[model samples]
Target chain A: MSVYTPLNEEQIIEILSNYSIGKSGVVDGIKEGITNSNYFLKTSVSEYVLTIFEDDNVNLDFCLNYMEHLARKSIPCPQPIQTNSNDSYILYDKKKLAIFSKLKGQTVSNAKITNEMCSQVGKVLAQMHMYSEDFKKNFSGVRNRDWFLNTYNKVQGELNKENASLLDEEIKRYLNYDCKELPTGIIHSDLFRDNVMFQKNTLTGVLDFYYACNGYFIYDLAITVNDWCTNSTFKIDHDKQKSLIGAYEQVRRLKNIEKKEWNTMLRFASLRFWLSRLNDQLFPTDGDLTTVLDPDHFKNILKDRKNYSDKLE
Target chain B: MSVYTPLNEEQIIEILSNYSIGKSGVVDGIKEGITNSNYFLKTSVSEYVLTIFEDDNVNLDFCLNYMEHLARKSIPCPQPIQTNSNDSYILYDKKKLAIFSKLKGQTVSNAKITNEMCSQVGKVLAQMHMYSEDFKKNFSGVRNRDWFLNTYNKVQGELNKENASLLDEEIKRYLNYDCKELPTGIIHSDLFRDNVMFQKNTLTGVLDFYYACNGYFIYDLAITVNDWCTNSTFKIDHDKQKSLIGAYEQVRRLKNIEKKEWNTMLRFASLRFWLSRLNDQLFPTDGDLTTVLDPDHFKNILKDRKNYSDKLE
Candidate 1:
C-alpha cells in the first residue's frame, strides 16, 4: 500500500476538472493498498478520496457501479462519485480514474476487534446483502475456487512438503462445492477487518469493494467470519462468530441450505485466500508496494474450519 | 475570529454538495487565524483549506478574486475554487464559504524569521504588486484610516492615558497623509510572519487575503519590513530590512517619493495594527475564539520607527 503513481498539483487539478467538486489544497499518499494509488483530497467544502487505479484489471463498471447502486439504497459504503459527464469513471493516462465520497470512521486493528464490532459488521453486511437484492449485476472474484486450485499448483513446488500437501488436501475436499443448490446474491468477496470502518466500536462504513462479486451469501459470511471472528492463534472465537452471525440473522437469516454449507464455505474462504497469499509470495509483483501478507495465518484457519461441523445456531 | 462557527459533519456535507470536491474523511480545525473559521481537510486524493468568514464584512469578490488573479500569475498565493455555478463563493448558512488550494510551506515562527525569508517575502510581495497591475477591482479595508481613528476614540476611555496618548500622537501625525502623491496599488495589508508561509527559509505562500486591499506600495513594504526586520526587542533588524527591501527593489524600484515617505509609512504601518489590536483588547468580542493579540508589540515598533528616518538605499 505505497504510492506507485505519484501525482503533482497540476495533474490533480486536471482530474478535478471532470467534476464540480472543489480543488485540493494539499495531498499526501495513503499507504495501504496494493492495486491503486490513493490520495486524501481536502477542499474548503468537504473531504474526499481519490483512487487512481495502477492496474488495468480494476473493474470500475462492476465495483464502482455496485457501490453507486448500494449507496443510493442507503447501504453504509463509499459511494462512487460520477463525473460531471455522468460516467462512473474517467480514463487518466489510460488508467481508471474515479473519486468516492469519503466514509466516516476507521478500521479497527486486529487486536481491537471485539464481539460488539463484529456484531455491527455482521449487521451491515446483512443489510448490504438485502439492500442490493435488486442489483442484477453478477461478478466472480479473480481468486475464486478455480483460482484456489490453480494458484496451489503454481506455488506447490515452492512450499515445504507439509504445507504443499496441506494445501492440496484442503483444495480437494471442497472442490465439489455445489453453488447451484445454495442461495446466492452479491457478495463483498473481501470483507476482512481492514475493509470495515468503525466509530467507537460501531461499524460506520464498509470499504474497498474491489473484490465484490456475485456469489453464495454464505460465502460472504464465511469470508467475513474467518477474519473478524478469528483469534490471535487463528482459531475461531466462538463468542465473536456468534455475535457476527447472530446480528447478520437479524437482518437476513440464513437458509437451511446455507446452514448445511457453512463449514464448507468457511473452508473454501480460508483455502482460497491462503492459496492467493501463497501465490503472491511466490510470484511477488516487482514493486515496493507489494505488502506480503502472511499466508500461514489463513492456512491455520483453513485447517481449523474443518475441525468440527460448524453449527449456525 | 477563531471558529466562531463550529460545523458538524452534516453541515460540512451540505456545504460540499454545492461543489464537486470529494468529501473529507477527516477534518480538523486549524488553530492559527483571527478573522475566520478554517479547517484542514484530508480526503483520499488531496488536501485543502476551508475558510468560513465569521464576519459579515468579508470581501469575497475583491479578496478571493484577487487571490484567483494573483494565483494565475504564479504568485505564491492560494487560488479560490469556484462553485459549479461559477460563483466565487457560496453562502453556507448565510456565511461566506470558499476553499483554497493549500500552499506548500508553513508560516515561519517569529523566533525563526531569517533574512533569507524576508528576502523571499520581499520578492513575492513585489511580484504580487506588479502581477495585479491589470486587476482594476479595488478593496478598502474597514480597518483603514477612518476605522483606526474612530476605534481610537471608542477605546480612549478604557486606556490608562499613557497608551491612549501614544496612539493619539501617532494618529495626528499620519492623519494628513496625502494619498494622491503616493503610488497606490493592491497591498496585502497584514504581511505578518504568521500570514506568510515558508519552507526551509523560503517563502512559499502569502495567506489571509481577507486583509488585502488597495493601498500605497510603500505602505505594504513598510508593513513587511517592520514585521520581517523587527527583532525580539521590537527594534528593526537592519540587515533583515536591507535584505527584504533589496530583493523588493530588484523587482520594482522605489520612487524618490516612496523612499522619502518610507519611515512615515513604517510608523503608519505599526500605527494601524496597533490601534486595531488595542480596540480588540479594549472591546474583546463575546466568544472563546477571540484570541487577544497584544497591541503593545506594534506600539513598541511604532516608537522605534520614529527613532530613525528609514532609507531606501
Candidate 2:
C-alpha cells in the first residue's frame, strides 16, 4: 500500500472511456509499484496504460509533455491517448489522469542484461537528451540537491547526529564544488531495467517518466547504466558499461568536462540514491507500507566513490 | 538548518553545566546534522560533545547503553557525561540530549586511507561483534528484509515500471533467501572514515551510534569494508577488500553461509546506497542546504558490484 489512495477498477474504466479512443476491455491493476496506481489497459482499437497521478503533479506534467515531444521526434515511447473531445488529458476527481499506448514487450529482470540492450538504452537516452529546446520550453523544477534537502529535512529526525553531519558535509561539498554545465534537456531520471521494455532482442519502449525533468542529459545515461549495467552487487560490469557509454557517446560525443566529471558524477549518483533511501527508511508517511531499504548497501558505493574521486585527482 | 530544532549556545551550556561534574564555560555549536545536533563544549576542566537526538529515541537510548557497555569492556569511545541528577541524558524542550567527554583526535578525510587502517578498523569491528551475552542482552533490534522494502517504497515514484517490477521481484527473491543467523549484538551501522577518529596511527575513538542496531556480525565486517576499503577510481579496492576481510576473519571466522552471503550482501549494500542517494537527489529538503550528490556514482558501484559478484561466484 502506498501513502496515497488507490483507484479501483470502475474508476479506472470510467477514466479510460473519456480518452480519445474508448477502452479495449483490458484493465488489470499493477500491484508491483509503491508509488502510483498503474493499470494495464487495452481497448478494442489499441492497447494502453492508464496511470493516475498519485504524487508530484508538476513532475507528472513535465513527464507527460516530454514523452509527447519525444514521441514526435521519433523516439519510441508510449503516446498519450487524448480524450473523446481530443484533449490530451482529463482532470477527474482531483486526479490528473492520462492514458498511454501499451508498450509491447518484456522487461529484462535477471543478470542477463546484454551489452546490446545497454547500448540501445544508452542511444535512446542520448537521442531523448538531444531535445534541448523542448525540455527548456516545457519543464522547470528544482535541481537534484534541493529535492534531496527538502525530503531529507522531512525525515531528519530519523537520522543520527553523525549520519546527519556527514550528510550536511556532503551537501556543503556539492555546493562548494563547481558543477560542470552540460547540454540541458529533459532527462529520464529513473531508467532502471524495469522502466525499459524489450521484445526478444528488439528495444520496445522507455516506460516511467514521473521523474523526468530538465537537467543534464548525462544524468539519464548515468541512471540507465546504474540500473541496467550492474547486477545485484556493487561491481562494475566493464563490458556493459563500455557498450552503454560507447552508444551514448556515439550520439552526444562526451565533452572534456563531462568525461572529467564522469567518475565524480557516478559517485554522486550512487550516493544520491543511498541518501534518499536512508531518508525514507528514517521517515515514513501514512499509507506507505513499502519496506525500507538498507542504508548499508550503499556504504561500499560511498567508499568506491571516495576511491574513484582520488583516482581522478 | 535541519527540520529538527537545534539547541542554542546558551541551552547547550546549560545542559553541559547541568550534566557534567566539571564547570561548563563556552558551548560552541559544531554541526547540525540530519539526525542529531552536535556542539563542542569546553568546561574549565575538559572538553565534551553535546549531542541532541533528532530521531528514534528508543534506538538512541539502546545505542547509548550499548556504547557504555562497550566502554566498560575496554573499547575506546567517548564516555557519557552524566547530568547533575546523575542521568546520562535529559529531555530538554521535548528532545532527548546527552553530553559526552570529547576525545582529542583528527578525523581521516583524505583518499590515502591505508590498508593498515582498513585492517585495524576491520579488527575493531570483529572485536565488537564477538561480544555475545551482554551485547545481545542489551540490544535486540533484528535485521530483516522489511528494512530494505521501506527504502524501496520511498523512491518508488522515481522508478519506472520495469525497474519497479524488478525491485518487487528482487524483494521476493530476497525473502526466499534465508539469511545466516549469527550472534545478534549491537553493530555500528555506519563505520565510515569520518566516524572513526585517530591520533597518529592509533585509533582514538569510534563515533556515530545512530545506525547501531542488532544485526549479523558479518554484516558489520561488510559495512567496514564497504566504507574503509576502496580503490582510486572509487571501485572497491579489491586488494584493500582482501586485507580488510582477512583482518576481520583473523578475529571472527566467517561461517559458510556468512561467506556465501558476502558477495550478495556486498552487491545489495552498494545498491542500497545507490537507491538511497538517488532518492535524496530527486527530492531535497530546506535545512538540507548541503549538496545533492549525483546518482551516477552509485550506478558505477552497482556495476562494480556485478563484476565482484561474478568473481565471487
Candidate 3:
C-alpha cells in the first residue's frame, strides 16, 4: 500500500468543498489499495475514503453506480458518498475522485482464512452477483482472455522451455475456447483476499470494484477460489475451497457446464494472473513506486493445477 | 509513508489480548512515521496507534516515561496505553511494542501554516519544554555535533569542491564554538511541521518523540523555526518566525545568550540535517524501504542561512 499523489490539507479542504460533509479533520494517506491513491478522510462529521483513480480509463459511472446500486439492495459495500449537486464523482486535478463511506472490518490474509470466513466470502460473492444482475451499465473486462494471450506472447521468450510450453498451451487453449457461451453477468473479476474484509466469521465489506465487469460468473468464482484457497506453496487448501464453493452453491448453484469445466476455469484463472505478473515484470510500469509481484508464484500455481488435475476433481 | 512490517490479523489479535482495550476490530498499517511500524488500531472500544519500535536500542523507558510524564501534566501528547500487567511497553516478536491513545487533528503542511497556527505551535512547544523540565531521563541527542562531524567526514569525499568547502567551514565553526553553555533540556530534536498536528485554531497533538533528547531548548526552537518558517526556495518567512518567537516568549522567554546565538543555532540545525541526509546518500541503509530525503534541500537552507546571516539579525 502506497500513496502516489501527496495531496495537502488545503487541497483536501478544497476537494471537500463540493460535498456537504463537514470540514475535514485528520486526512491520513491509506497505503493499502494498489490501483489508486486512497486517503482516509476523517472529517468533523464522518470518516470516508477519498480515492483518486490512477488509471484514466477507470469507468467512474460503472464503479460508482454499481456500488450505489449494491447499497440500495442492502449489500455491504463502500457506498459512494455523493456531492451537494448529487454527483457521485468529482474531477480533481483532471482525475476522477470519489469518496466512499469507510467500511467496517479488517482484510484477512490467505493464511488466516478459516472455513467459516471462506463460506462468508463465497456467500457475499454470490449475493453481489445476484443483486447486480439488473445493473444496466456494462464495462468490458480489461484482463480478459485476449489480455492473457497478448501478455503471454510478450513474456514467453523470458520463460524457460517447460514454463514457455505451459504458457503457450494455456494461451492456445483459451484462444480457441468460446467463453461467451458460458453464463454472462457482472463479475467482481479480481476478488483477492485483500479486496474483502472480515470480522470474526462474518464478511463485512467487499471492495476495489474497479475490476468489476461483464464476464462469466464461473470465471469470477474461479478467480476468488484461486486467491482465497491457495497456500504459500501454491497448493489448494481443500477445506477452504470446498467451503467457498459449497456456500456459493447454497446462494446460486453452479450449472452443469460450470461443474464440468471447473478445472479449466481454475487453469484459466491461474494463467491470467501468471501472464499479467510476467508482463509486469517484463515491462515494468514507470512510477514513484512500482511493486512487480512475483510471477513465479502464479507459475507454480498453474503447474500444480495442471499436474494435479484429477485430484482437483 | 510506508509500512515495513507485515503483521497478520492473528498476530494482531494475540497482541491485543495482552491489553485491556477490548476487542481489536480493524487494524490498518499507518504508513506515516519513518522510524517505526505503526498501525492505526481500531477496536470495539476506541482507536489507538500501535507502534512497534523498529530499532532495538530505542530507549523505550525514557521515551515512554517522558510521554507519560508530559501526559500527566496535561500536555497535548499521546499518552502511552498500558497493559493488564501495568506495563506500558510489550515485548512482541523481540520488538518493543507500545500503544498510544490516538490523538486528534491533522498535520499541517508548510503551505498551510498560518500566523495563528505558528503562534499556537510555538506556545505548545514552549508548554512542552516547560512541562518536560521535571522529566528525569536523559537520552543524548543522537544527531549531536559529534554525529555531524563524523557523518560529514564520511560524505565529504562525495561532495563537489564548493559543497566540500561549505561542509568544512561549518564543521570547523561548530567544533570551535561552545554549545554546552546554552539552556539544556528535553528537546524534540526533529519537530518538523508534519510532526505537529492542529485543528481549526489550536494545536491538538505533538507526535513522533523518538528524536527527543537532552539538548539546547533554543536549538530545538531553531530546528522548528528553520523548518516552519522556510518557503519553497529555502528563504525564511520573517512574519512566521517572529510570530513563533513572540508567542514562545510569552510562555518561556529566551535568554540573552540564546538571542545572540540564534543565527548560529539556525546554521547548526541546517548543517545537522544536511550532514544526515548526505551521510544517508553516501552510506545507504540496507532495508526494504529507505527514504533518503534530498540532501540538496538542507544544503540550500544552510547556504542561504550562511549568506543571509546579516539579514537574519
Candidate 4:
C-alpha cells in the first residue's frame, strides 16, 4: 500500500478550500490501502485521512454514501467528510480525492490478535451488516464470481503443479455450489486484520470499505475468519474462531442454510485471497510502497479448508 | 521513487518546530530518489522540498554543502535551507531530514530532446564541475570499483547467456584501466535525464545529487552524454552528443588523456546503470510510486557502447 498520485501543497490547499477545514496541515503519505493513495492529514479542526482512488473502475457513489449511512446508524466506521458544496468527493487531475474522519486506533498485527479482539470484530461485523441492510446500494463486489474465474486464469501458471491442480479443482468446486438460497446483504467482502482498528482491548473502528458490496453475509464472515482466526502457520486458531463466531451469533443467529454453506464459504474465501495474492506476486504493478503478500499463505489456508472444514456451531 | 517513511501532521509539526519557516503546510510525497523519501513542501515564505534519506550509508554532509556551494557560484542546483539553529539537517527517528529551495522547471523526457537542449545541459554540467572544484570535500562515490564487482555478482544470473558473457567481459576490461592520470573533481555520477530539469529551451535546474562525489571529469561527461544523447533504442544520437560535448569543451576543455579514455568511460557508465537497473528489477523494494526501469535498457546501452565506441571530439 502506498501513495500513488502525490498531492503538493497548492493542490491540497485547493482541495481543502471547498471544505471549512481551516487550511491543510501536514499531508503524510500513509502506508495503507491497496488500490488507493492515502494520506494522514490534520487541520485545525480535526484529524482526517485523504484518500486518492487510483482505480476508476470501482463503485465510488455507493461505497462513499454507504459508509456515511452505516456511520449514521452507529457503525464504528470512518464517516466521509462532505465538502462545503456537499460533494462526496472532489476530482483533481482525474483522480477522485475524498477525506474521512480518522479512525480511533491502529490496525492490529495478525500475530498479536487475542480472542477478545476477535469477538469485538465479530460484533462490529454483525452490527455493520444489520445497519447497512436498508442502505439500498446495489454493488456486486469487485471480487465476485467473474473475478474468481478471471483471476484464476491469470495466476494459474504461477503455482506449482500440485498447487495449480488444487487451485483448479477448488475453483471448479466453488463455482458449482450455486448458493442462490443463502441470505445476501451488504457484506464487508474483504475484512482482513489490517482493515480493523483496535484501541486498548476493543475494536474501536472498522476501516477500508472499498470492497463492501451486495454479497452473502456468511461469505463476509468467512473472509473475516480467514484473516482473524488464522495463525502464522496458515492454520486456524480454533479458540479465536469460536470466540469470533460465538460473539457474531449473539447479534443475529445464523440461518441453517448459512451454517450448512459456512465451510464452503470459508473454502471459497481462502481461494479468493489465494488467487489475488498469486495475481499480485506473478504480475504486480509498479508502486512506491506496494506490499505483495505471499500467495502460499492463502494457498495453505484454502487447502486446509478444503481438506478439513471448520464447524460454525 | 516513493515515500518510505510516513509523517503524520503532528509528527511533521514537531519536525517543523525547529525551523522558523512558518507552520507546516502540505507535505506531499515526491517520486524521486532511489534510497530516500522526498516531499514537495510549501509554506507562506516559499515552496521547498523535504528529503528523508533512507540509506544510512551515504555521505550527507559533503552532498548537502556541495549543493549550497554550487548554487552560490551560479550553478543551477538546489540550495539547502538551514534550520533556525543553523544546522544543515535535522534528525527525526534516526533519519536525516533537510529542506531545499525547489528547483525551477520540470525534468524532460528522453524522446523530447533537441541539440540546443543538450548543449544547454552540457554548459551547465561543465560549469557545475568547475564551480565545485574548490569545495574541497573528499568523498569517494558509493558506486565505485567494489560496487561494480558486488552488483555484477548479484545480477549475473538474471541475464541471458550472451548478456552475462558480455557483462563479464566489459567489467574485466573496465577494471584493468588505470585512470589515475585523468583530472579528478566533483562529478554528478548519475546524471540521468530525470536529474536535469528544463523550462522552455534552457536547462533551469539540476536535481538529485545523492550520487555527487569526487570522480573523473570526462567520466562524468560520459554519464551525462549516455543519458542526454541516447534515444529510447539505447543508441547514441550523434548530433546531440556532438552539440553537448562541443558546448562543454567551450566552458572547460577536456584533457588528451580524458579523450583517450572517453569510450571506456562510456562503456563503464553504461555498466553502472545496467547493474543498478538489474538490481532494482530483480530485488525491488516496496514503494507507493516506485518506477523500476527495465534492466534491458541499460543492457542495450552497454552492448552498444562496447560494440561501437563513439568519438567525443
Candidate 5:
C-alpha cells in the first residue's frame, strides 16, 4: 500500500524501451501490494502494472513463470509482459522488476461475497490448481510449517498463556499429522477475498500470487474458505462454505484422504494465519509502510474451528 | 499516499445508494491528497472520486460551489456528483464527504513537464481563473499571508539566527508591501506538477482544488512557476519559466502591477510554502497517513529566487 521506488518519467520511458508495449503515457503508483511497489502504467497499446519487488526474499523468476504457465492455459490471471530481449524480468535499481498486463475487474469484498460468488471463486481455484500441475519450476511457499514454528518461537514471550499453548498444540498437530497420499499442487496460499476480482457475476481475475507454491490442495481450499466464507465476527457462513466446496468438488472431486482430513486442514490454515499475524504484530519488518493485520481475527477463527468442528458437518 | 479510511463492501454500497451513480463495483482507495481521504470509485455506469475532508477548516459549501461554477463554464475540472436529495455534500462518519466525476488523464511528474506541457498548463490555468470570476462563494485560502506570520512566529525559536532573521524580514516586507490593485480572483494556489494532469500535449484535468480561494492570481502563478520550472538542484529552469509565463500572457496579459511585483510574488509564494512545510515538520498534525513534504525544497527555491532575481528577465 505504498510506492517504495519513486520513478521519474525518463526512467519509466527507458524501462518501457526494453518492452514492446509501446511508449508510456501515465505511470500512477497504485497503493496496493505490501511486498512490492506497484504502478499502473498506461500506454498507447494497453495498460500494464509495473511491479518492483521490495522484499529480497521473493523469487521473481518462479512467480513470473508460474503466472505465465497459468496464462498459457487460458486462466484469468495477469500475464507478465516480457521484455524486448525476451527476458521475463528486468533490473531496476538492483530490484527485480516485471511488467504485467493489468487485470480488469474489481475485488469483491467479503461483505459482497454471495454463495454464487464463493462458488465461482471455488471453481477458479480448482482450475488454477489443475493448470499449475504442468509448471516445471518449483518454489516452496514461504509460510510453511517451519515458518509457523520459527514465528511462534519469536513471539512466544508476548502471547498470553492460552494463545501460547494453543499455538504450541497446533504446531505439534501439523508436524505430527502428515498424509503423504494427499493431493498436492501449486496453491494460491493467500487467496483472501481481496485477492480475487469480480466483473458482475463472473470472476474476471485472480491476483497476488506472491505466496504461490507447491502445497496441499485441500489446505488451499481451507485458506479460501476461512476468508471468503467468514463474516466480520469470524463466524463461518455455512451456505458460502458449502457452495464453495461443492462447486470445487464438481470440477475436481476431493481425494478420500483430503475428505478425511478436511477438518484438520481448516485448523491448520487458521493457525498458520494466526501465527503469521501475531509475528507481524510482535516482530514487525522494516518496510516503510506495511499494514499490520489484526491477529485476533484469525485467533477467533482458530477457536471456532477447534470448538465447533461439529458445526462444519 | 495512503488510505486513511478502509471501507468495506456494505459501506461502499450504502454510500453509493445516496447517489445515482449506479451500483458500486470497485472502490479503490487512491493514495493521493495529504489533507483528505480519497477513493477511486467505479460503478456499472461511471467512475467517481469520493473525498472525505480530514481538516475541519475546509469550507465544503464554498469549495463545492466554486467547482460547480467552474464546471458550468466547461472548465477541465472534476464536476461534483450530487446526492439523490440534490445535496452536493454528504455526512459520512461525521466527515464532510462528496463525490466528483473522476477526472481523466494522468499527472505529469516534474521530470516530464516539457516546455510545451508547461505552456498547456499555463493556458488551462489562465482559463480557470477567467471562468472562476463569477464564483459567488468566498473562502480565504488557508495559506494566506497572515498564516505565514503566525506560523513563522510559532516556529521561530527552533530556527537558527540567520534563518530566523530571514523569516522575520520576509514577513515584515510582506506586511509593509502594498499592491492593492493587483489581479485577484479564484486561484488554484497550489498548481504543482502532480496536481495537473495531461493527455499527450493537451491538458486534460486540474485537481486538488481544496486550496482554491480568492487570492492574487499573480501569486498563484508564482507558486506554480516555482514548482513546475525548478530543476533537481532547486534552480529555476529559465526556459520552462519563459515558456509557461509567455503562454499564460497569450491568454490573459499580466497587469503592469503584476509584472512590477513579480519578483515579490515569487518570494511571497516561496515564503508561504516554506512556512507551511516548516510548520508541518515542527508541529505535525494527527492525520493517520499525512505525507510530510520536505520544507527544504521550498527553502532552497527561496534562496535561489533571492540570489538570482535577475535571471528571470
Candidate 6:
C-alpha cells in the first residue's frame, strides 16, 4: 500500500485521453513519489507521464503553459498533451490533471552525478534562464523576499530564542537591503539534481515545475548552484561551482549588481531551505513518508553566508 | 503588534504566581515560539524564564520533570518553578505553561562559535545523555522519529514526487538499520549551537527541552555533531568534528558499535532536518514570523551523506 493517494488505471487513462500527442495503452503507475500520484503511460507510439495535482489550489494551468513555453523555446522539458477538447489540462473529479510526453532518461542520483553531468545540468539551467525573458507575462510566481518571509513565518513557533532573533535580523537585513532590479521571467524554483533527467552525461529533460515562478534570473542560478553544485555535507565543490557558474554566465551575462548579489543570493537561497525545514519539524503533515529535515543544516549555511558576505564583492 | 497572541503582564504574572520560585519582577513578553511562550522575569535574588506551553496536547509535564531531574543531578539547566498547587505546570485559559530559573548567556552564532565552544557543546550533550538515563520513567516527552514521521505524513498531499521518494527511502533505511541501542534515555533531539548558552566558551546551560525524548545516546551526539561541527557551507570541519567527538567520548565512552553506526547516525540526523524542512516548504502555518527553511539545503546534505556514508565503514 502506498503512503499517499494511489491513482487507479481508469483515472490514468481518463486523464491521458485529453493529451492529443500520445495514445493511452499500458498505464503503469511509477513509484516515484510518496506525496503525489504519478503514472507512466506507454502508448503504442511513445511513453508519457500522467500526473494528478495533489493540491487542488496549485495552479496547474499556469504550469502547463510554462511547460509548453519551455518546450517551444528548445528547453528540455516534458511537453503537455492537449485533451480531446484541445485543452492542455483537465479538471477531473475536482482534481487538476495533465499528461505530458515523458523524456527518455533517468533521475540522476548523487553517485551518478559526475562532473560532466554537473556541467550539463548547469548549462541547461542557464539556457532555461536565458529563454525565460517573457515569462512574467505568461506566468508570474512568488518573488524572493516574500517567498522567504512567508515560509519562515510558518515555523516561527518552533524557533528558539537565538534562531528567532537571527531570523528577525536576517529578515530586517533583506527588507533594508536595496535589491537591485533586474530582468524578470519564469524560473524553475525547485530545479535540484533529481528534477533534472540525464542519459550518460547528456541532459534529456528537466522535471518538477511545481515551484516555477517569476523571479530574478539570478535567483534561479543561485538555486541551481545551491542544489547541484554543492556536495552532501553542504560544502561547495570549488571546481563544480566554477564550472556551473561559467556555463550560466556564458549563456546569460549577469549584470554587475547581479554578480555582486550572488553571495547574498546564495545565503538567501540557503536560508530559504533552512527556514522551510524548521517549519516542517514544528508542524508536520499526514501520510507524508519523508523525514523532517534538520534545521541545523542551514545553520552552517547561514554561518558561511555571514563569513563570505564580503567575499562575493 | 505581534504576529501571535500576546500574553499580558498580569496574565503572565497570574500564571507564574502558582510556581514556588522566588517572586521575580516580571517583564513584558520577550519572545513567542511555536512550541512555547517566553517571558523574562527577574527577582530580587536572580533572573529566570517563564515558558508557557503553546500546545496543551504535547507533554509539558514530562519536559518540566526532566528539567527538574537534570537540575537535581547538578546539570546546568533552567530549574522549573513549581505552581501554587505544587504542580510543575499550570493550565491558564486552556494553555499549558511552566516557569524556570533563567540562565544568562549569549547564543553561539557563527560569528561567536569557536573550536573550544564546539568542544564544550559536545561535552554538555554527552553529560545530558548520561544524566537522562531515567528520562522516560521520570518525564514522558516525545521521541524524534515518531514526531518527524507523524508530521511528514500529515502533509504528504502537498509534497512533490522527488521529495516523497526521498522520504520513503530514508524512513526505510532508518527502520532497517540495526543501531546499537545504548542506554535508552532522554536525548535532546535538538542541541544546536543556538540552543546552548555560552559565557566565554564555558557552557552555561542547555536550553530547549521541547524536543527532549527517549532515544539512543549516540543519536544525541549525532545531532550535536550535525549542528556544531559544520562550516558555513554545511561541510563538516574535520578538526571541529574530531574535537567534538573527542570531547563527547571523554564524557561518555563510545562503544565500537556506536562508533560504527556514527556515519549512519549522522546521515539519519541530516535526514531528520531535511524531511522536516521539505514539509514546511509545502505547508505553512498562519501568522508565523520565522522563515521557512529551504528544502534544497537538505538535498545538498542528502547528497553529501551519500559520499560520506562509505567513510563510516
Write down the TM-score of every candidate. 0.51, 0.46, 0.50, 0.49, 0.50, 0.47
Model 3 scores a C-alpha lDDT of: 0.78
Ranked candidates (lDDT, high to low): 4, 5, 3, 1, 6, 2
Candidate 3 wrong stretches, greater than 4 Å: A1-313, B288-290, B310-313
> B146 in model 3: Cα distance from truth in Å?
3.1
- Cα lDDT tens digits, model 3, A1-313, are 4747677888988998877555445678886776688888876444678888888767778888787665543356787766756678899898889887787678876447788988888877876776555567787867765677677768888988988888889888888888555787889988898888876566778888888888888889988999999888888889999999888876676777787777888888898888888887888766623477898888898888887772333
- The parts of candidate 6 lying over 4 Å away from their true place are A1-4, A16-24, A33-35, A136-144, A310-313, B1-313
Point to the candidate with the largest DockQ: 1
Model 2 chain A: ten consecutive residues of lowest lDDT: A304-313
- Binned by DockQ into CAPRI classes (incorrect, acceptable, medium, high), candidate 2 is incorrect
* Model 1 alpha-carbon drift over 4 Å, by segment: A1-313, B1-6, B288-290
Regions more than 4 Å wrong, model 2: A1-13, A23-26, A134-143, A154-157, A160-162, A231-233, A310-313, B1-313
| Worst ten in a row by lDDT for model 5 chain A | A67-76
Give the DockQ-based CAPRI class for model 3.
incorrect
Top candidate (lDDT): 4
* Per-residue alpha-carbon lDDT of candidate 4 for residues B1-313, written as tens digits (9 for 90 to 100): 5556667888778877866454566678876666778888765334678888777877899898787656533355776766656677899888889877676689886448889998888887887776555566788878888888888888898888987898889889877877689998889897778888887676878888888888889889999998888887889999999999988876677888889888898998888888888888888867633688887888888888888866655
Question: What docking tier does model 1 reach?
Answer: incorrect
What is the DockQ for all candidates, taken in turn? 0.02, 0.01, 0.01, 0.01, 0.01, 0.01
User: A1-313, model 1: which lDDT tens digit per residue?
Assistant: 6645677889878887776444443467788767788888764323567788877765668887688655533355776665656676788998887777677788775547778988888877886776456566777766666766677678888989889788778878777656688877788889887788887665668888888887888988999999888887888899999999998886676898889888888998898888888888889887744578888888888878878578675
- The per-model lDDT (C-alpha) reads 0.76, 0.64, 0.78, 0.79, 0.78, 0.67
Give one digit per residue, the lDDT tens place, for model 4 in A47-136. 678888888877999898788665543355776766666677898788888888776678886448889988888877876765554565
DockQ of 6: 0.01
Q: Write the per-residue lDDT of candidate 5 for residues A233-273, one digit (tens) a residue.
A: 77788889999988887666788788778778889999989
User: Looking at candidate 1, what is the lDDT of residue B84?
Assistant: 51
Q: How big is the positional error of residue A102 in model 5, measured in Å on the Cα after superposition?
A: 0.8
Which consecutive 10 residues in model 3 chain B have the weakest lDDT in total? B68-77
Which numbered prediction scores highest in TM-score against the true structure? 1
